[model samples]
Target: MKYTVKGTQEEGVQACAKHFIGNEQETQRSNVIYPDGTEVAAISSNIDDRTLHELYLPPFADAVKAGVATVMCGYNRLNQTYTCQNSKLLNGILKEELGFLGYVVSDFYATHDGVPAIEAGLDMNMPGPWDSMTAAMTYLGGNNASLWGQNLTTSVGNGSLSEERLDDMIRRIMTPYFHLGQNEGFPSVDPSGYFITAVTAGYIQTSRGAPPARDVRGDHAKLIRRIGAEATVLLKNVNSTLPLKTPLSIGVFGNDAGLPADGMYVLGDDPPYPGVPRSGYEMGTLSVGGGSGSGRSTYVVSPLNALMARAKNFGGRVQYILDNALIAKGDFSTLYPTPEVCLVFLKTWCGEGTDRASFENDWNSTLVVERVASHCPNTVVVTHSAGVNTMPWAENENVTAILAAHYPGQESGNSIVDVLFGDINPSGRLPYTIPRREADYALPITNMTGDQSRNASAWQSDFTEGLYIDYRHFDAMNITPLYDFGYGLSYTTFEIVGTPSADLLQKELPPFPPSSQVEPGGIPGSGMKCSKSRLSSVTQDQSPAQLLCSST
Candidate 1:
């Protein structure tokens, strides 16, 4: 990929990794959310050994480790931190820690955090979305980007940037752009040449591979099935009554139930495919997958649209509401309209770059489920999200199932519906834990703060739970999550029973005792969600809720 960057530089085009440090999902990202180190330990706290090393920081680390000429900062904060201005993230981590040589780029309309960012070490702002940049510059009164301009002038005058640190920063930033010929000589155009279609098969071969269905699309389709399968997490299965066999009339519905891949958010470049919707925008202008820190796009793939297309194999059974109205406000009864082994397609959207506060913004879906559960006793809920969200209707007995597809990429829509309808069994687990309530945030106060940030050591003492991170401490400590880590459901039940076998393999998962869970009141469902409201925002402020499990 760095080679591609070098090639882009050769062509003299600005190549940007918009929104650095993985700020992909979450609406109203501008408003910060100080995730308690306790709640978002996967990405926030230094827990989960694997996540700490590979999952969360590896990509950026790899890019910089490979020398991505430039990086864009994001709008949201990470674990009570604004990613843009946190110098620890910027100078300390990216440059100093990971040895990043490139300059920092800010996302559209994300410059509001510029002052702190500059102090921390951000270098550029773009498109001037709000166009308040000029005003900001003047307001700087020579206090640019935490004195970026002033710092440079001072540093150069005093010979700081000339020093090794500044020299390194300069090389990182200028190389790629310079290679693009923006900063230097004519970038290597030989690497930037497109096959001119006629110039290729006219210039190259029959543009196909792998024999039989050798088209590139076929290979990609195969890969999507694999990745999407791994990314599909099974949320819950109560009585172990899952992995359903025998052909059953499983109702399918959702804003995304019937659609094909649009590849709108595919990282870097993924071209249009046969049967895929063509974007109204030019291919060059079509920004697929990257952080909002990259830029904005007028296109997206509707899960309903893809679900409809993918469900064609099931025939007349796959019914769509077609009303085109998002059930953002009304109940499913009002919108879903029909009722057979139902799958309600709930589509949520507040805007281009933002978030919806509650897990359920309205009683709409729950109300819909309440109404439809009687109509079709079997129902499953599937969610497509960019980040972890609060699930308001999680405990409804009528709601039989749930699956979380985190922006499952291009083929997500089709893959999700397939899993829910039994075409596939979900195996993916939550990448991060799902908190029961919005207020469960480790630090609710962080998001409200403006651009200025002072608490560098805040997370050290502030993470709420000192060491209970991710599933390790939390689950072991009896901290009940809305959904536990490693929580995934499948259609079939396979009990892991054993009598102390000596030979164990990876596939042979170790068995645990089939302990009976005795509920305190001696009643089955009384205390399950009864204590839900007990975790209100007010309560969260005064005291973090302890997981209280009692014997029946």
Candidate 2:
């Protein structure tokens, strides 16, 4: 967060911390009133105050302390009230408690009521006007699509909202704009290049002009390649099967190894209607995920492309089967003579607006890996995924190695080859626990059925797990995971020689934060303070608490 805000602001851009609080799931995120008169309320994240402060509020608090320029309230309700209009969250926690001077903006079409949201502390409604479908719904009295704009002005005029609150909103919205010196020489926005097209039902086209063709990728490709290589996580290696020595022949399989068959590297080329599943691998390499959070790259380098280039340079033979079905059928022996090594590339697509059905790999990738490993003794599995994926074949004798290459972006192929052929050592670690079975999680993705179904008057998602989530839940339940969090492998090894110790200098510590006046950035001297203490101790246990002060 510090790097993101400082780096972007240094380059004349503002970074925004988003999904304010308790937006855990995406099911029924937004309010909807169907043409058939059926209504689905936004899901409510019912969080206890202690759990909210301890678990969900730290990252956002850190982001505020880092002087982030903007904060976006999420679509879901926080404690049964829409986040944009939740007073305890936006006004109490964010604005007053954390001393966040930046304005609060709503997610796209997330605001429900103008007066309540403004009074609660929402400074801005994203993309003010409603789209055609929303406007039609509003006209039919099914929904109140536009929360601000003319309605906001009328609310203030009719005494439903106060002018003082409106002015405060304006002040908060402009504080960061001037503080960041955006008025001096901010770059002009090229709407044609960045604006969304209006061909879709829920989107309003901001500009009618054709988007200008531009290639703004300066030296980012080089940086991307280096990061990609460093981020590749080597999950398993048997008998040093990796670091390929320019084998005489290599066999590549899986649709993920190449571009999409339809040649659509980027999404949004086709209309985006709700419930219509976007083409995954059939569109190309899974460099990014799907939905609003997905990114766009000028080009994506698939693993097959990088392997073929390496093979050509080394005068080696390369054969590939990009069809998932053909590989899973286990009948490719005639087309593929046994090669020195076989590389199977797999991926799972996940993003905002939806949750994956399971942790299993998509496109029948588990079957593909089993079939390939059965035939090829020296099989190397490379997986690209957004999150945890169950590996049923990790213990197979034929599966010599496995690399968890999570979404390498445009340099996917080169980065994997770099780690595979010893050009780069894999150093990335898993961010979440990968359990042996889905049941091991204990805390399953909540299915709001019964009275809490989508058609119910209100959708409630109780945070029953509390602070015990992910690895913490595993530890509390004493369940062994398939691969623990932060689990990763490297070609080389290192060891610490000396014991670690810490000292506590301050005899007394304040239980609450300083009550300093709120400033543009934050409370003065509110940042954590640490120092060497007179009382010192050393322990062989080497827990992280032993190395740092409690204040830190």
Candidate 3:
């Protein structure tokens, strides 16, 4: 939060802390009524006060204390009231207890009632006037009415809302602009070509003629490549199979090794039915997940492209088969032909609108890996996924290595090759526990009850698991995970050589510091400071840490 606020505001851009409270699930996330007269109420996260404070509220509090310019209330209800208009959450906890000075904004079309929303301390209703139908057909275009523009004026005229409260809202909204020094020379707003392209498919032109083409990409590719390489977790390397030595013959398999055959810009495809080939959208090298959060790349270098380039440089033979069916059906002797190494790329498709039905990879990715590994002696499997993927073939003897290359952006191919060929050491760690079974999770995604064909009205998700989630749940229940969180591998190793020691300083910590005037970055100098009082000795022959500690 501090980094984002400081960085963005330094460039005259206000940072927004979003989905403010409990918004755990994506199912039934918005208020909408189907054409068949079925109305779906946003799921209410029924969190107890203690659990709310301990688990969900602290992150938001930290964001507020960082002096975030804006906070976007979520789509879900908090204890049965819509978060956009929840009085206790917005006014009581956020503004009063936390002492947040920024304005509260609602998620896109999340606000239901105008009066209740403002009275509950909602300062902004995003995208103005929007109904359920308009929200549902957002891409296709529909009604565009302001929910608060006239309604707010009318409310204040009738004395339903006080003028002072209206002024307070304006003051809150404008405070960040001046606080961030946006009144000084900031870059002029340009027509968003990306947005125009998405909505109108390049059919609509901006009123200012053509959107000015500017290349703001300043060494971002280099940073992205470095991050990608560093984040590639080496899950398995039985015989030091990775850091490839420019083998004479290499065979690459699976759709994930190349770009999607159909196209690159497809978004949001239905999960393929049994026996149907997975759509190009799902099968291709998944640099990013689907839905709103996904970004468009200027160009993507596929694993095939990167490997071919590398092989060309080394005068090596490169062969690849991107079709999943061909790999499943082909004879190993004819297809692979005694290749020195076989690389299998696989991915799981996950995004914003829905939850994954299972932990297994889509389109029988495991079967592909198992099939290839069975034929080839030196098979390396690379997986691109958003989260925990059940690797049934982790124990397979034929599989020599495994790389969890989670959703690396445009530099996906180069990054993987860098790690594979020993150009960069893999140090990425798993952020989530890989459970042996889907049932091992503390809670399964709540399914719609009452009817299968229509949306359910009583769509309430109970937080019965409390704080026992992810690795915490596994620890509490004594359920051994397939791969525990923070599990990662490196080409080299290190050993702790000495006992850690810390300088002792005893002082009674106060419950609260003396109250002060709240600034944009919260109370000045309130952020916790870390002193270099602890030390530990470590030994490593050749590692990143050794380079840093060499001078010491």
Q: What overall lDDT goes with each candidate model? A: 0.48, 0.75, 0.76
Q: Give one digit per residue, the lDDT tens place, for model 2 in 1-552.
A: 666777787776778998998888877777767777777878889998888987788778888888888999998988888898999899999999999988999887787777878888899987664554665454335566476877888998999998899888889889888888999987677554334333223344334565764567899988888778888888899988977888988999888899755443344322244443533545356877666645656677888889999999889888999888888899976654688899998888776666677888778888999999988999999988889999989999999999998887788889889889878777687778899988888666556665556464467788977767877677658888888777787676533223223333565644632222212222221111111112223435321221112221
How well does each candidate superpose onto the true structure, as a TM-score?
A: 0.52, 0.85, 0.83
Candidate 1 matches the true fold with a TM-score of: 0.52
For model 3, state the Cα shift of residue 48 in Å. 1.8
In the range 203-278, model 1's lDDT, one tens digit per residue, is: 3334353123212244565567556755677786655433333222445543344432333332221111122222
Location of the lowest summed lDDT over 10 successive residues in candidate 3: 543-552
Q: TM-score for model 2?
A: 0.85
Candidate 3 lDDT tens digits, 1-552: 666776777777898987878888887777658888777788888988877886678767777877888999988888899999999999999999989999999887788888889999899998675653454344347445577888789999999999999999999999999998888886766556545443423323443555654668898998888789888888899978877998989999988999755454445542212222333264569888765556667778899999999999889888887878778775565654567999999888777656777788776787788788877889999998888888888889989999999989988999999888888878687868898887898587666755752555577889987766777677668899988766787776543234323332435423532222312232222121111111122435211111111101
In model 2, what is the error at residue 175, expressed in angstroms? 1.9
- RMSD to the hidden true structure, all candidates: 14.0, 8.2, 9.2
Off by over 4 Å in 2: 131-145, 194-196, 199-209, 265-279, 448-455, 500-552
The local distance difference test score of model 3 is 0.76
